[model samples]
Target: MQIVNKAVVFESGHEEYAVPIQSVISIEKVNFINPIPHMPLYMRGVTKAREDLIPVIDFESVLYNRSLAGEEARLLVVQTESLQIGLLVKDAKEIIDIPQEALKQMGIAAYEKTKYFIGVAAFSDRLITIIDPDILVSSLEGIKDIQEYMKQNKLFPA
Candidate 1:
């Protein structure tokens, strides 16, 4: 028996990253994102996906401290503990299975620097940094309020 984790691979700048496939609910094109004022710079806006309005975070903005990049943009609609948030990325067309043994856990320094990183794993010839979606959502400031706003507005079914 082998322990393998299925993950959705995405690109941000020159680096590759992955999140548990189980966390992702859908992959969508960049239809339209309605910007919300006074939110975090990285929090691009809210977008409708599969009848649910999810908070979209610009991955490039978060990582590179710049606006969203890449020619083809996509939204990785991932379900965290309490919210179905959208992560806008350069690309998200690959789903791969990563073996448990392949994961290289980050040391204390790495963990201290990034709380959302689960580990690093080599897939194909590139390095993919595994990200924990729960921590990714929780680590952001003012995200809770966005979740609450969605719930209170009945944006999606309760």
Candidate 2:
């Protein structure tokens, strides 16, 4: 089977995960000074992008329960059904293509806990966790209507 060699891979501390490149819009450097109250700790913060204030999640903290130092971090812009979110990671890696058969789904149980990893896919001898942006977005609370939710919270300044 022909494999697609396009995915946005990034490093969070020592671990690496890949999201379908097609789902990404842009990668940016983010410094968040405002955050939503009563949200999960893994939810890093929020920042303004264009006319929208995007919610950002700490990829490392959510996955591994460790916060990465933000000195050399980057925000990966992933498109969700409702809004564009920035996933904060330590660094971004190269995009690569691997065979489709090499990917192994971790099943529903794994995804139920993490809610980030859609499946586990192999790349050569190493395994790269494949992330489904849709799952990530859907798992976030109150993201049903992204625009209205942000507006209700006044995530943007007047």
How do the residues 1-158 of candidate 1 rate in per-residue lDDT, one tens digit apiece? 21238889998887899888889998899898998878889988889999878889998887788888556789999998877889999889699878777777766425553778878887568788888888888888788777776778777655
True-structure RMSD for candidate 2: 3.7
Estimate the overall C-alpha local distance difference test score of candidate 2: 0.72
TM-score of each: 0.89, 0.78
Q: For candidate 1, what is the total of clashing residue pairs?
A: 0
Query: What TM-score does model 2 achieve against the real structure?
Result: 0.78
Q: Which has the greatest lDDT? A: 1
RMSD (CA, Å), each prediction: 2.6, 3.7
Model 2 segments more than 4 A misplaced: 1-5, 107-111, 141-149, 153-158
Taking the tens digit of each residue's C-alpha lDDT, what string does model 2 give over 27-48? 7777663766766767766886
User: What is candidate 2's CA lDDT for residue 88?
Assistant: 86
lDDT accuracy of residue 51 in candidate 2: 57
